[model samples]
Target: MTFFLPFSTVARLRFGSASRIHIFALYRWNY
Candidate 1:
C-alpha cells in the first residue's frame, strides 16, 4: 500500500496538469 501512495500522487499531478492544458486548448478553440 505504501508503494501505491507515491504512484497515485504522481498520477494525480500529471492528470491535473494534463486536464488544465487540455482545458486551455479547448478554451482557445472555443474563442
Candidate 2:
C-alpha cells in the first residue's frame, strides 16, 4: 500500500499521526 505511494504524496494527505506512523512503517518494510 504505502510502498506504491510516494512519501511526498503521503505527507500531503496528512492521514493523521497514527496513520503517518503506519505508513512510515510500511515504507521501512518496503525498503
Candidate 3:
C-alpha cells in the first residue's frame, strides 16, 4: 500500500524553525 499527503508542506512552512526561513529567504533571493 501507498499513501501521500500535501498539508505536510504547509505545516512545515508555518511551524518550521529558523532553517526553513533561511532557506526560503535564499530561495526568494535566487529568484
Candidate 4:
C-alpha cells in the first residue's frame, strides 16, 4: 500500500499539471 501511495502521488502531480493547463486554456477561451 505504501508503494501504491507514492505512485499515486506522482501520477497525480504529473497529470494534475496537465489537467490544470487544459482547464486554464478552457477558461481563457471562455473569456
Note the Cα lDDT for every prediction shown.
Answer: 1.00, 0.81, 0.73, 0.98
Return the clash pairs for model 1, or none: none
Native-to-model Cα distance after best TM-score fit, residue 18 in candidate 2, in Å: 0.3
Those runs of model 4 whose alpha carbons end farther than 4 Å from true positions after fitting are 1-9
Query: Which portions of model 1 miss their true places by more than 4 Å?
Result: none
TM-score of each model, in listed order: 0.89, 0.49, 0.47, 0.56
| lDDT per residue (tens digit) for residues 1-30 in model 2 | 676678767766776776889999999999
Residue-by-residue lDDT tens digits, candidate 1, 1-31: 9999999999999999999999999999999
Best-performing candidate as measured by lDDT: 1
Clashing pairs in 3: none
| Number of the candidate with higher lDDT, 1 or 4 | 1
Point out the worst 10-residue segment of candidate 2 by lDDT. 3-12
TM-score-based ranking? 1, 4, 2, 3
| Model 2 alpha-carbon drift over 4 Å, by segment | 1-15
Name the lDDT value of residue 18 in candidate 2.
68
**How much does candidate 3 score in TM-score?**
0.47
Q: Candidate 3: where is the Cα deviation over 4 Å?
A: 1-16
